[model samples]
Target: MLNKTRGRPRGNPDTKARIAEAARELFLERGYKGTTVRAVAAEAGVDSALISYHFGSKQRLFGQSLNLLCVESTALDQALQGDQAGLADRLLTSVTSLWDATAPTENRMALQDDDTMRAFRDYLESELLVRVAEFLGGPDATERATAAVGVIGGLIFTRSLNPIRSIAALPSAEVRRIFGPALRAALHARARQH
Candidate 1:
């Protein structure tokens, strides 16, 4: 027999979906620091262990919940072979779109939606980052990617702190007007250093 769940009932696919969705919503609303397993289970209407069972742990669950659609360039796995200009365009579009799509609509758990946020330093050292860095080029890719992802993810995550919903809204030209030069500079610097 399945383990008698402790906090809430056992979950099926529907229930699992609810839990994951709830976890994402609440984590975004509360930030990783503020959210807890109990709270996630409550929001999901499933036992807390079900969350553990489905996701292994809070961090893993959080990562899984954040598996947003990836742009092809960023998905390269290892190599900056993609068109640099195209990669820049896709990166901005995907990030901004994901940020916009983070709205806590359907389930609307007592949590604001956010595109995603890793635990900063911890996530930076994570396997996910490792793979993403490899996609940028490899271990050496860190310097190139770090600045770009940091600024982009920071913008998306920090917007959550604002009371205003549309604060993140910006035209592509404007975004390019700002980060484009800096990112270009960063890539060049990395190329020189490497």
Candidate 2:
């Protein structure tokens, strides 16, 4: 029985947005491990080939799945540029709270799953760290800030997988109690040397 429910229909700009939006919603819900390109195409009400045409490939689509770096990077830059006295407290709270259940565990797993984390690492090291360098001071700050961000980000990424490993559940104030002055002094001292 050849059932012809051909998915060919006239799609507009709005329709394209809907398709991408549907794919993103379903992907995050079911996960990259579970959702198929065909399924996303179905949910989006477009041809599977359209998904490929628009996004190129599933891995490329996944990268476009969210716009996160803008918020993540901006928050840190803002905190770093803010009043020095409460800087670490603000940074800790921002980083900790941002990590809480916001990123789907599957997204982190997506990194390990695809072998593209190296690409992402390189991008972050070059682009993201460069932005941090400009915001904090200059090139000298890049190395230190990149390493520090990596440590904090890695810790949070780990905590995402193992809920019990998350000591972030502690009050931001408490976490800041230890991390605040020490980090602030060091970074502030680093900045002042400019």
Question: Which structure among the candidates has the greatest lDDT?
Answer: 2
True-vs-predicted CA distance for residue 123, candidate 1, Å: 3.9
Model 2 clashing residue pairs (backbone): none
Q: Write model 2 residue lDDT over 55-172, tens digit each, in one string.
A: 6665455556543321254455556666545655666676666655365354455455333344445434555455545666654576556655564555444444344444546554
Q: lDDT by residue for model 1 over 1-194, one digit each (tens)?
A: 66565644534548777887887787667655667889999887777877877776666666556443221223232233465545555555555554455552311222233335333334434433454466667445777677666665455444433423544456545655666666655543455542
Candidate 2 whole-model C-alpha lDDT, 0 to 1: 0.56
User: Candidates' lDDT values, in order?
Assistant: 0.54, 0.56
The regions of model 2 sitting more than 4 angstroms off are: 1-74, 84-87, 101-107, 114-116, 161-174, 189-194
Highest TM-score: give the candidate number: 2
TM-score of 1: 0.48
Q: Give the Å error, residue 22, model 1.
A: 11
lDDT measured at residue 55 in model 2 versus the true structure, 0 to 100: 68
